[model samples]
Target: MHPSQSQSCTAFDGHRLIASGPLREVAAATKQAIDAGAKGPVLVFDDQTSLPVEIDFRGGVDDVLSRLGLASAAADAAPRGPGRPRLGVVAREVTLLPRHWEWLAAQAGGASATLRRLVEDARRGEQDRALRAGEALDRFMQAMAGDLPHYE
Candidate 1:
């Protein structure tokens, strides 16, 4: 979901609502959840708290509930662990050539490790872009300070 549309709801154990706010606001809430021994998934919403956009825990519901000292009585309980990062609703599977697969295999020690590295690399690149953008904005503001005509 778009960052602008992202919201989050934080609950402790299972039923206690700690906070509900925008995704950006969840950073502080996440720390609070950790502090409060909340080991379950942190549910994210799109625009409404009643409907979840994403769930992040990475340890599975059983593990999360165990850590939080809660029980899942519902047989069809939502799996708590971090859900797979969805690209979008219309995801298309790409068939890699054998050589391409071989190359990726060679780079990845294993499939899991390779996937992890790819994700980390992508995340880092995004962070670097943001940093550079911020720097550029700072430089632009500094350069415009004395050059721009000001009234009032």
Candidate 2:
């Protein structure tokens, strides 16, 4: 996983949020703070997915990620030339009704190009999706941490 894809990790001190950023920095800082005798059970959460992620606070950031087989940061972003596929493109079959196919074919760029543009438009909605995911996570956290002193 790319470091950016890991999204943000938030470290909490007891019920209070202490640090928020990439997993590496958040983990290292949390470890340092804990080592300095901060009260912990420091919960680290993936901000985007709202899922819990573990960190070996005992190890350095690079050591941890390398051991886990995740890239530490954006490793490469080679530009795609004309007629070249972008990274992670997957070819799959789609079955549409005849009329649907006709509509797609009628599009200025035809089916494949129209589909690609549609996918790109959906990709642009990622931020809105993230916000919704965050909201869902907030509701979850509220329920999970409700009894704690600083739940919100």
Maximum-TM-score candidate: 2
| Residue 15 local lDDT, model 1 | 42
**Clashes in model 1: which pairs?**
58-82, 60-81
Span of ten consecutive residues with least summed lDDT in model 2:
76-85
lDDT for 18 (candidate 2): 71
Mind giving the per-residue lDDT tens digits that candidate 1 earns over 35-110?
A: 5687554444333323343434445444433343334334334554343346332334445679877877788386
User: Scored by CA lDDT, what does every candidate get?
Assistant: 0.49, 0.70
**What's the residue-level lDDT of 69 in candidate 2?**
55
Report the alpha-carbon TM-score of model 2 versus the true structure: 0.53
* Residue 122, model 2, lDDT: 96
Residue range 1-152, candidate 2, lDDT tens digits: 23444477788877767789866567666767777777866777777666667666656655665654555544434545544245443456475789999999999989999999999999999989979997868854874587788655
